[model samples]
Target: DSFKSAAGSQTAKVQQVVTSPDGEKRYWFKLEGGQASPGMGDSPEPVDATITQDYETAAAMSKNELSGTAAYMSGKLRVSGDLMKLMQLQGALGQMPTALKGIDVDY
Candidate 1:
């Protein structure tokens, strides 16, 4: 249940800090392909990692103009979570390809 615990911890952080356009913040990540689904009733809540960037910045990053760490530090991306969990996730994510599906990058 490590994944669940990780997800729960992340959900708590997102709920505490993120908000939607109407001032409501709620989200979840759908784990499809590459990994098994956590199963019904065991999925983690979603979160939005907002990246404040224009098309150019996005395009550049998409083309590998910046590394993930660099993007984060430069304000191209922002994330919220338990620092430990976040770091763990980052390590996992570092093993993934920058691009997923048709998206420029996984972010």
Candidate 2:
């Protein structure tokens, strides 16, 4: 996936969660270059789970430089609604595309 910068620089895929439901648990996963669609938010329909985190922090966690549990303890990450659902979702999220490889961003 390509992430097009406002300045016209094309970056790698940076998955961003647009919305998530509260009860039903819905998640939207859009690759940077992928098309945007509606109904991305959480819904009443049952789903595995949903989690939202800062992109940079997620990258760090993905690399094992930080731990989700640790971040939560440090108040670096915030989770709402179902706590167990969030823990269960962690495994699946760790397998997704969390890093924007080869993409240069000004930190």
Candidate 3:
């Protein structure tokens, strides 16, 4: 998986929760295998880390109008669990065009 490949041995399950005006959405990534998808529910494996953001903030991240690191620093992004795992994947995460590339944002 792209995430696993990117992090190499740094394996973890990352959950992304988005709260938007329309509704809420969730996604997960198993960094070891780089597996990511939508929907929120129980997982057989444990979640090592989680990132929470509202739709607009996430969209800002995608367009590089804002940054996850900066957002996190400013408390716009909420993080829980294994912060190290997120940090380890920082390089990979930073390359993202948008936090949710599939979703459209006005920018």
Candidate 4:
């Protein structure tokens, strides 16, 4: 609900890179028609924004122990491209906790 509302009519292709001792993992997702669909590896097409961060920072952000805005400001996270578009997806990203609640992560 919130995601859809916040997403509005926005459309974008976003890529994310998380680096850790295990190396780097990349993910791409598309926000279109008020829905977000994620995929592994690189994006099939060009992206509007790319966010890169360490695994710890990403984990912290996922657990709500840290905020994305703070991470970016503190140099823990890096983002490029249409930042405003990415920020607009903040509300959508906020739903991650609930959406990921049932999933079991190794770290």
Worst 10 residues of 2 by lDDT: 6-15
List model 4 lDDT by residue over 1-107, tens digit each.
66677677878899999999899999988988878888999999999999999999988987878888899999999998889987887877776555556677777
lDDT to native, each model: 0.40, 0.44, 0.72, 0.85
Better of 2 and 4 by TM-score: 4
Q: Give the root-mean-square deviation of each candidate in angstroms.
A: 8.5, 11.2, 3.7, 1.6
Let me know the TM-score candidate 3 reaches against the reference structure: 0.70
Residue 82 Cα positional deviation in candidate 1, in Å, after optimal superposition: 2.8
lDDT of 2 by residue, 1-107 (tens): 22222212211222223222333323344322333222445443443334456656655765657877787788666665556755644443443334334445343
Estimate, for each residue in 1-107, the C-alpha lDDT of model 3 and write its tens digit. 34335545555677888887787777766655453444555445778888999988877887878978999999889999989878877866775553356677564
Q: Candidate 1 on 4-86: residue-level lDDT in tens? A: 33333322212222233444333233433333232222225553332244444444554656655776688765665444544
Candidate 1 clashes: the total is 3
Q: Where does candidate 4 have its weakest 10-residue lDDT segment?
A: 94-103
Model 2 lDDT, residue 91, Cα? 41
Clash count, candidate 4: 0
